[model samples]
Target: MQFIDIKAIHAHSAAQIDAAVAQVFEHGRYINGPEVYELEATLGKFLGDSKPLHCIAVASGTMALEVALRALSIGPGDEVITTPFTWISTAETIALVGATPVFADIEPDTYNIDPKEVEKVITPKTKAIIPVDLFGQLPDYTALETIAEKHGLKIIEDAAQSFGAEQNARKAGTFGHVATTSFFPAKPLGGYGDGGAVFTADDQLAEDLRAVTNHGCKERESHYILGTNGRCDSLQAAIIQAKFANFRDAEIALRQKVGARYSEALKDYVTVPKIHPGNTHIYAQYTIRPKNRDSLGEALKAADIPSAVYYRKPLHQQEVFSHLPCAKKSFPHTEQAAQEVISLPFHPYLSEADQARIIATVVKAV
Candidate 1:
C-alpha cells in the first residue's frame, strides 16, 4: 500500500547499514574522509569511464550540473538547449551558471526531447545540449551525439532518474562529456541524505571540479580556481557504498518485470511508457499518459490507491520563465503531455495483487 516501500528496503539492509555507519564513526572523519574516495573508486570502476574520469562526490544533483557547466566555461551570453518537460532544477542549473536555457519540444511516444526539434532551437550562441533521461528512460543518444558533433556542442547526460540503465551496452554513467546523477532518496541508488556526483573522461575537468566544490582550492591554501563547498558527506558516502553492494544485475532485471506488469495491465486504459528498441528502461517513475488523467487519478485515490502527476506544465509556461523568448505554442506534444501524464505507484517491491487493484481502478475510471 505504500507509494514507495523504503521501509521494506531498510528492513532488509538495516544490519549492513548499521555496520557501515559504525565504521565511519570509528574513523572519526565526519567530512570527506576515506569513505568518500572509497565510493568514488568503486563507482569509477563500475562505470568504466576510462583513465580521465575522476568522480567528484557533491552535495546534490543540482550542484553536479552547476559544477559541470562551470568546468566547461559556460556562462552568461551562452544558451543551453534542453527540454521544458522536467523538474525545475534542470533549467535552474543552467540559469544559476549564468546561461540561458532554450526550450525544445519532446516526442509524444517516448516523452523525450526530440532531436529534430532540438536542431531547430540551435543558434550561433548555443553552448551545449542537455538531453534529459526522463522517467527512467533515455533519449536517442545516437542521434543526439551526431548532432552534438556536427554543432561542436558539449553533451551533458542528466542521469538523475537513470543510473544503471543501458542502451546497446553503453550505460548512462559512461556516455556524454559529463554525466550527472542524484542520490535523492527517491532515486534508484539513493542514500540517507542528498548526494550527487559528476562523471567525465577529462583529467583537467575532474581536477577543476574537485577544486570548484571545495572553496576553489588547488591544494591546501593554494587557491588557483573559484569553487564552492560541494563534497559529499563521509556518512552519506558510507551508506551509499553499502547500498551499492546490494544493487545487482538481478535487481535491474526485476525492474523490467515490474514495468512489463504495469504495461500489460494498464495499456488498454492508459498510454504506457515506451522503450526504445535498444535501450532498457529502469522504471524510476513508471508514468503513463491517460486520456482522462485527473479523473483516473481521483478514482485510484478514492480506492485508497495513490497516483500523482509527473509534471502538470512544461517549464516555459511557469511564471518565472514566461518572458524568455520561445515560439508560440510550437511544442504541442510537450503541452499535451502536461495535461495527460499520470504517475502510478511503482517501485521494485510492487506486488501483483497491489498492481491489479491499481490497474482495475484505472480501467473502471477511464
Candidate 2:
C-alpha cells in the first residue's frame, strides 16, 4: 500500500491531462499562457470568494510566503507570530524574509495556535500573524481576525495544506489579508510539479506578487524591483487546470468520507484530530497519535500499510531557532504532539478495503 495513491489519481486524470499538455505543446507558450490564467480563475472560483479575489501563481508555497512578506515590507527586526506545531516551512519562510518568527503554543485539542497565546506573544515588533492550517483544517480565524484587528497586524494564512478547507462559513484562503497554498503532489489541489499561488482581496498586493514572481518584471522583461525567479511554468499550470476541471469537488467529498471512516474505526485505538465547531476539515493527512508512534508506524509498514509523521520536531525546539525568545521558552503541547502524531495512508482513491486493512493493522499494533 502507498502513503497516498497519487498514481491512482494520475491514472484517472491521464486523458484529460494529456490533452492539456498537447495544447500547451502545440502553442509553445510554455512560460505563462492561457492555461495559467485558466488555473488562477478556476481556483479563485473554487475558493468561492465574493469580490473576485486575486490569485498570483508562483513556483512554490515558500515563494508565495516570502513574496507576501516582502510585499508587506516585513523584514529584519520584525516578528511574525505563529505556532510551532507545523512544518518547518512555516518558520523557515519567516526567517528567510529576515524576520524573526515568534513562537506560540497550540491548543492541545485542535493543534491550532491559540489566539490568546498569539496575543501574548505580540509586541511592538509583531508585524504579522501566520497561523498555519495544519493537516487541512482551518485555524480559529475568527479569533485570529479579532487579534489582528486589536494589534493592527496583517494576518497571512499559511494555507499550504488547506486548499479546500473552511471555517465558520468562510473558506481558508478568504480569512486573512492573504493566504498561500502549495501545489506539491501531496496537497489536496496540486500540480504536476512545483507550483503555488497567493490569494488576496487586495488588488495592489496581487499586482506586486505578479511582478515578484517574474524577477520584479512589470512586463515580459521590464525590471521594476528586486525579486526572485518564482514564476509558475505553463506545463504545471496546464496539469493544475486539468485536475481542477472534474475531480476537485469529488476529491474533497471522498476525503471527507474517508476521514470519517478513519475516525469511526480508529478513535478507540488513538486520539483522532479534534476540529473546532463550525469548521470543515479537508483531511489532507488524517493524522492521529498512537501512544507508541514509531512502533505503530513500523508495524503498519510491515503489514504493507505505510504511515508517517507530519513533523518530528516542533519549530520552537528546532536548533536553528533556539536563540529567539519564543523558541527559548518551553512549549509542552507542541513538543508532545510532535513525538506521537502519525499520518496514515490518506487519499481520494483509498478504498474501503484498504481502510479496513489499515485499521486492522493499526488496532493490532496498538
Candidate 3:
C-alpha cells in the first residue's frame, strides 16, 4: 500500500481538478493569477472567526514562516522559541530571519511543545514563540497566549500539519498573532506542488505580508522592505482549490475515522496518539510509539506495508544547529520520542481491508 496515497486522493476530484488546471492553462497567468486570489479568499473564509482572516499565499511553508517573521521585524539578537521535535523548517525559518531559535522540550504524550518549558526559556531577548502543531494536534495555545500576553511576545502558530484541525471552536490557522500552513504534496491539505499561506486578522500585517512575498512592492515599480520571490504559483493554487472542495467536505472527517480505528486497534500493542480535550486532529501522520520501533518497521517492510519516521533526530541534535546553546541542552521527551516514534501508512482513502492488514502486521510485530 502507498504511504499517503496521493494518487487515490487525486482520483476523487479528477474532473474538477482537470477543469481548474485547464482554466489556468487557458489564461496563461501562471504567476499570481485569479485562481490564486480565489484560493486565498476561500481559505480565509474557511479559517476565519468573527472576521475573515487575510490570507497571503506563498512559494512554500518555509517562505510563509520567514515572511511572517520579517513582517514582524524579528531578526538578529532576537530569540524565537519553538519545539525541537518538529520539522527543521519550524526552527530553520527563525534562524534564516537572523533570529536565534531557542529550543523548548515537547510533551511526551502529545509530542507538541510544552508551554511550561516555553515559559522557562523566556528572556528579555525573547520576541516570539513558534508553537508547532506536531502530528496534527495543536499545542496548548490557551496557556501560550497567556504567556505571550505577559511577556509582550508574538505567537506564530505553525499549523503546517494541522491545517483543518480545531481547538475549542477556533480553527488551527486562526490561533496565533499570525499562522501558517503548508501545501506540500504530503500535507493534510496538499496541492499538486509546493505552496503555503499565512493567516492574520490585522490589516497592516496582511498588507505587509503581501508586499514581502512580492519583492517588497505594494505597487508596480516601488520597493519598500527587503523581501524574496515567495509568491505561490497560479497552477498550484488552482489544484489546491480543486482538492480543497473534497478535503473540506469529507476528508477531514474521514481522517478522524481512520485515525480512531488505528488508535483503537493499536492502543494495546503500542502507544497511540493522545489528542487533547476540545481539539480535533486531522491525523496528518497517525504516528505511534512502539517498544521496538525499528524492529516493527522492519516487520512492516517485510509485510509490504510502508512506514516512516516523522523525525529521526530533534532539531537541537542536527548538525546545523549544534553551535547554538539550546543544542547542548537536554530535552528528554524530544530525545526519547525521536527514537520511538514511527508513522504508519495513513490517508483518508485507506480501505478497511488495507487497514486491517496494517493493524494485524503492527500488532504482531510490536
Candidate 4:
C-alpha cells in the first residue's frame, strides 16, 4: 500500500549494503573516500561512451545541477529554458546560479518539455536548455540537440528521474553537453542517502566539475574558481555501488515489466504513460491522467490503496516564480496535466496481488 516500497528494495540488497558500509566504516575516510571514486567509475561504465564519460559524484542532485551551471559559466544576463512541469529543483538551480529560468510547456502525451515550445522561448539571452527526463522517460533529446546546435546553446539533461532509462540505445546520462542524475533513495539507481553525479565527455569540463565540487581546488590549498562544498560521502557511494549491482542486472527489467502491466491493464480506464519511440522507460512512478483525478484518488483512498500526485501545481503557477514573465503566461498542457496526473503505488517489487488490487480499484473508480 506504500507509494514506493523502500523497505522491500533495501531488503533485496541488505547483505551487500551492509558489507559495503562496514568497509567504509573500517577505513574511516567518510568523505571522498576510495569507494566514491569506485562508484563514479562504475557509473561511467554504466553509461557507456567510445571514450568513457567522466562522472563527478556530488552531495545531492541540486548540487550536481548547480555545479553544471557554474562550470559552464552560465550566470547573470543568461536564461535557461526548462520544463515547468517538473520538480522545482530543475528550474530553481538556474535561478540559484544567477540566471533566469524561462518556462517551456510540456507535451501532453509524454508530460515532458515540448521541444517546439522550447524553440519559441529562445531569445538572445538564452544560454542553455535543461530538458528534464520526467517520470523515467527522456524528452525528445534528438530534436533538442538539433536546436541547441543551431542556436549554439548548451543542453543540460536532467536525468534525475530516468537514471536507468535509455533512448535510441544510449543511456540517460549520455545525452546533453552535460547530464546529471540523483541517488535520492527513490531513484532507479539510488543510494542510501542523498547523492548525485555530473557526467560529461569533455575532459576540461569534467576537470572543472571536479574542482567545483571540491572547493574549486584542482590540488590541495589552491583555489582556481569560486566553488562550494558539494562532495558526496563515501558511505552513500558505497551503498549506491552495492545496490547498483542488482539494479543494473535485474531491477531495471523488473521495473519495465511492472510498468508494462500497469499500462496494459489501465490503458482503457485512463491515460496510461506513453513511451516514445526508441525509448525504454523505468517507470519511476506509474502515473496516469484520469478525467476525474480527484474522485479517483478518493476512491483509491477509500479502498485503502495508496495514490499520490507528482505535481499538484505547475511551476509557472507557483508563487515563488511569480516575478518571472513565464509565471503569467498560459501553458495549457502543463496546467491540464497538473489537474489530472496521479501516481499509483509503484515499485519493482510490487507484488502481483497488490498490482491486481490496485488495478481493480482504479478501473472501478474511473
Per-residue lDDT of candidate 1, residues 70-174 (tens digit): 878898999999998998888988988889999999999999999999999899999999888998879999999999999999999999999878998888766
Against the reference, the lDDT scores of all candidates come to 0.85, 0.86, 0.94, 0.93
Clashing pairs in 3: none
- What is the lDDT for 97 in model 4? 87
Q: Kindly indicate the candidate among 1 and 2 with the higher lDDT.
A: 2
Candidate 1 TM-score versus the reference: 0.96
Q: What does candidate 2's lDDT look like per residue over 266-337, in tens digits? A: 999899988789988888798998889889988987887878787788888889988887877888888888
- Which candidate achieves the best lDDT against the true structure? 3
TM per candidate: 0.96, 0.96, 0.99, 0.99
Q: Candidate 2: deviation at residue 30, Å?
A: 1.4
* Residue 228 local lDDT, model 4: 86
Model 3: how far residue 73 lies from native, Å: 0.5
For residue 272, give model 1's deviation from the true position in Å: 0.5
lDDT by residue for model 4 (230-336), tens: 99999999999989988989899999999999999999989999999999999888899988998999999999988889888889888989999989899999999
The whole-model C-alpha lDDT of candidate 2 against the native structure comes to: 0.86
lDDT of 4 at 15: 98
